[model samples]
Target: MGGPGGWWRRKSTPAKVETYTRWSFHFIALSEPTVIGVTAFGHLEARAALLVMVPVAAHVALAMVTASRALDWTVGRRAQPLRLLWALGAATALVATAAVVLGRHGPGGPGEDTGTVLGSVFGATLCYGVGLTALGLKDRRRVVLLVTGFGAGAGLVARAAGMPALAALGTSAFVTAASGFFAATSAFSIWLLNTVYVLDEARETRARLAVAEERLRFGRDLHDVMGRNLAVIALKSELAVQLARRERPEAVEQMIEVQRIAQESQREVREVVRGYRRADLEAELHGARGVLRAAGIDCEVSGETDGLPAEVQSALGWVVREATTNVLRHGDAKKCTVTVLRPEGRVVLTVRNDGATAPHGSSRTGGTGLAGLRERLSAVGGTLDAGEAGDGEFRLVAEVPLTARPALEVAS
Candidate 1:
């Protein structure tokens, strides 16, 4: 039980939606036997009911199998279940015909009410089978046509079996309405599942694009930093080579100048790398707000980073980043609040979001992101705490001891 629960919780949104949809259709198919069987038993003897349920059981099995395949096709996991659809349609026609024959010619009871019970079963079977067939279809017009065809077939068959014209029309209308409802439901479910998957893919694409964009920016910055120095070094080296070839003492000075420029380039590269690694708290805060708002989440930030130590700001900035990412990736958050407070000798940073039932990566279930954050904060004598705050809220608090900053820096 625990293993299954954990697995479910770990599933991404699209996986969960697909799982739910597949199982829902299976259960719907399963329910047909129970509902139709009970109605059959209520109207006929046990033996007669059993006879009627044999084909229903077969129809249900075919529906379940077809629906499963259809769902796979919907997700591009497999081809359409055309053979199963035809088999199910045939089974549905057989069952309805059996019901009609039993009603018109078989033993009767309760003012000949067997016809009424069987007619209802006919409609239900048509509904379930038609809906299952619709799952494999991608076109709205085709689904409409499928339902209409089944309804018309039901009425025409009834009329040939001696049902009054008006009664046959009524049966047709009933079957159409019932089958249309289930067909529409199946169509909508497929649409929703597809939409969810598309949105999930789009989100992942957006994240990848952001990473690529950042890489380009970093490359551009590095180019700008190194371009001029390298050009000058190349020019000076050529001049040095010419002077050396001419046996001039100026070659030595030119070589030294080239070495100096090379060393300066190395230093600038280190500065660029260091700046890239260090996170600025003020920039992170505004960036988080912009990103969250762009994703349609409301973000409220409260706090000032003025006078905070560089190490403290860097550690807290990382916390904000990880928290924001988790909110976007794991939870369906509508609003988030980030607060920073300085009390006594410690700086406290709190990030809260009303999107999760339980806090993600609480101490009990340490996650990679949170563990990395803890390591970063621990370097600066900080501690991290995360837990649920009730009413579908999760909060993460990080506190860094300001008084220990000097000692930490000295130790580092």
Candidate 2:
């Protein structure tokens, strides 16, 4: 359990964006009904307003469901909502027809106030329905055609219901503009959500590529170190065998040379492996900054790696690497700061990041990654402490005495 706010905090950036976009569509759909209800009540008597409200509310509800299903289809979460779209279209036409009838023959016999209120009902219901209906369409040109057709239809329908030519034209214009606006907004939201998912995937890919590149480099180094030495050892051993078969005295010297070369190869291989495993403190700091910035996180690094013992630097370099990895893997961090300082014969390294949430938990308290880091630090007599730092921040601190030596290796 990640506490009270766990559910939302645990969602990744893409999930959060999707949730926000979906709810925003629902809220927009709800507004159509809210506005119509309020306008009717203000302009008409209670009985007439109630009459207008019922069909309009039903139309809005259908539009909302259609929009939800359409979004699900757009994101590949569900099949195309063809039936729901057809149902909403039919409901919108029926509601608009009813509003036009009410306006022409109202309670006070077709007065201006009654006509005004019902006309708004007619236009709003038609426009919102057009917008939600457009969501099921993927082609931009098709959406444009749909909105244009509805605008022209609104005018023809109003004219047939005995509205003046100018008022009908005005209704057509209103539906066109409003419907197009809502449709464009919905399209943009879907695009933005997809882009967020793509960018997150690219970030993960870049991290994997970095690891693969390092492995290739290590492999190349190992081949270069061992290839020539192994060839020399094989040649000398064959030469010694041939000399001994001929009863030559130099066979002993030849075998001694082979042994010496074999021992030398062993020593060279150890050095190559050691150099590959060693992490330079300066290089790690620069790398951390680059990697974090590439992921769109603002990273600030302060202090120096100069004048530090090699063993101390190696241990802290690993701390920096592990800390940087954790920042990328967990949390929706925006800014990360790393600092190194020396005071009173002790070297200290600290990494801190903001946008920490409770659900992801601290990387320090549990995980094999951090446990391995703790073991590395212990070898150099260093200590690591990590936890929340208040105001939505997580911090990790590592400290080592300057005079600390590497732990002695145990003989196998």
The TM-scores, one per candidate, come to: 0.63, 0.61
Model 1 regions lying over 4 Å from their true place: 109-113, 239-251, 274-412
C-alpha positional error of residue 213 in candidate 1 after TM-score superposition, expressed in Å: 1.9
Model 2, stretches more than 4 Å misplaced?
Answer: 106-108, 247-412
Error of 2 at 3 (Å): 2.9
lDDT for each candidate structure: 0.81, 0.79
lDDT of 2 by residue, 109-195 (tens): 788878878878887887788878888888899889988988888888888888899988998898899888877887788778779
* Shift of residue 25 alpha carbon in model 2, Å: 0.4
When superposed on Cα atoms, how far off is each prediction in RMSD?
Answer: 18.2, 18.8
Best by lDDT: 1
Task: State the lDDT of candidate 1 residue by residue for 1-412, as single tens digits.
Answer: 4785998999999999999999999999988888887787897789977877888888898899899899999999988888988888888888887777667776663245577668666777888999888998999999999999999998998888788999999989988989999999999999999999999999999999988966754664455445545655666788789899999999998889789868967886786766555657898798678656745689999988899988899888878877776676666789999999999889999999988644354443477567667767887899898877878788989999997753333111
